[model samples]
Target: MTTTDRRPMYWEEFSPDSARAGAELACLRRGVGREPGNVPEMWRFHRVRISDHEARTGAPSASLTAEHAALTLFAVHQQSQRKSMHRQGMGLGASLRLLRQSEKYKKNPQALNARVNALATSADVPELAYHLRGLITQLRGIGQPLDYTSLFYDVLAWHSPEGQERTRRRWGAQYYDWAESKAKQPQTD
Candidate 1:
């Protein structure tokens, strides 16, 4: 049975069978055409906002389009990432806010991160963080949050059934980090 304060399952934790199971699960998740169906409708609707606005108001004729938005979002995301790679955690809050803005894109934060992790396996963790940071930055510039509640760490734990394992791993690390920091604090007695 799993304990309440169980640790994250890293490469070190998997048994032979469990490792195979994990690989199988990863394959299933990565299979062609496997899209997350429960992604919020608001995200879908947000994509249409630019086109919808263009149609109704005839603005940004030369400056805005879906592609523009996507690029701008990417650029902002990249900028934020540069900041993060320097060991700055303060930008996390702002970066998350940006992601919330770009929620309209086909992929949400979790999906995007998973994709990046899969495709960019050789990339350093700091590099990945930079990418995510850029995404958040772009989203925020356009007036959106990185969507903490909908895309938060805690939400991951309870939301997707498949995500639970990964979420657990991530949360375990986060909790451990927090606990370690707390443990190092001096008592004021």
Candidate 2:
């Protein structure tokens, strides 16, 4: 039983502004300034958000939206590329450590997680989902089973499926199966 074992099982609540600030802070801690937009993934999220907002409010600011969209695309693309570089055999602790070593992740790792989780819930839901799936796949390849739903609930404050119930179902099923198997086995001397 370590400190992690004693931490809260889950956290609930989502605040968009908090998430945005956390993200900026995370980057600053990593020694990186506000990243410029230039990648497809980041751009997609920005585009989705801008479009959604514009549709809702009938605001017409194509130039501003385009600029922000470009910046976001670059950021997400860079992150994905970075994740691929370190994916093999890296655990959460290792990843966190690596991130912290950089100027961008010096602050609370949990907070960074929340920021990333929030980014994933940005307007382009499908793109975020695909990118996350790839990241999770890479983590899994390294023998890590990322509990993303739990992570999102604990860290991010974005409008998206929290996946809490799904996580519970998976955990319960796995735990029960393990328990049943253990009960059926003869005791080892």
Candidate 3:
């Protein structure tokens, strides 16, 4: 197989109806809050991908760490949902913006805004994960799904200062731009 063929498929690219993807997600769900090596069940699904990434890059498997964090967050966001939580084209900022607009939170937007601010300013992955858990719970309550594939890559990029700035800018733009666009639309009424 060519190198491209060996690369792991992003979750968003996977067909929502694929049984193989469903099974893989279920396995990842079982790994919520667990460390990478501790989840022996996930090894089969993620190990080869992690190894392949390390081999190709000649770097340590930080991909393993990022994937673990993203998958665990996906599990939390997906719990008890009949539909897949890995929605294509939905990024974290967009999903959070929806959550901010939900009736449950519309009355008290500051609470959600504070959470988003905390998440954006997190100093490290562990801190980010901690803040993300709360937001993911809120997302789950509102049935807001995001693209786990984007999130995984975002987390991987978080390891670098430049990536953090770029990611934050993208998210901020998505979040605030939605509100601006909505305001600019002419109301039918």
Candidate 4:
């Protein structure tokens, strides 16, 4: 087995912060979601968050919540795919790295997944907040949208087995289904 095979699963304890993170991510996929106030509430907070993100920019740990890092990475991945498709076009966004940027964003999930897996082995939930904060701050320093949360579900589900199972129930990805199936399959070890 390789590193992934040997690595401990991310959701070993499944705390409330993690669950809130998962639920928040889940709600986004459905609508305004039950958390952060429905549509208007979500948009209000999202807008404020955007402004805060811009102001904080390179140093975003101050603004990060329990769900922030996963949310950011999740948002980045969706945006990257859209960018790859030539869908979103902003001033500088249209001018540079559209395709290349998309490729970079596309690869982020696995990179993030690996990082989270490593962190999971050593860090607990609260420490994860600081760890994720550092991760986001560093990414933001390079001018990435490390604060975006447009695709929160991906980050939630990517890191949590519970979120993945819920996502599979809601959206139905064969990969998640396969991963969930591992619970039933006899272990090789």
lDDT of 2 by residue, 57-163 (tens): 65634333323322222233233222322222332334433443445545655654554454344454334443443443334333333332233332222222554
Candidate closest to the true structure, highest lDDT = 3
The backbone clash count of each candidate, in order, is 13, 16, 0, 0
**Tens digit of lDDT per residue, candidate 3, span 1-189?**
222554553454545466576676687777776666567767665522556656676554656777788877876776666677888689899999999999988999999899999999988777777788899899999888898777877787788888889988888987766445666989998
The residue pairs found clashing in candidate 4 are none
Model 1 poorest 10 in a row by lDDT: 33-42
TM-score of each: 0.21, 0.22, 0.77, 0.26
**Which model scores highest in TM-score?**
3
Ranking by TM-score: 3, 4, 2, 1
Residue 101 lDDT in model 2? 43
Q: Residue 12 in candidate 4 has what lDDT? A: 20
Every candidate's CA RMSD: 18.5, 15.9, 4.8, 17.1
- Cα displacement (angstroms), candidate 4, residue 44, comes to 4.7
Order of models, best lDDT first: 3, 2, 4, 1
What TM-score would candidate 3 get against the native? Answer: 0.77
Off by over 4 Å in 2: 1-122, 152-156, 160-189
lDDT of each: 0.34, 0.35, 0.75, 0.34
Which stretches of candidate 1 lie above 4 Å from their native place?
1-123, 147-189
The TM-score between candidate 2 and the true structure equals 0.22
**Alpha carbon deviation, residue 68, candidate 2 (Å):** 29
- After the best TM-score superposition of candidate 1, give how far the Cα of residue 133 lies from its true spot, in angstroms: 2.1
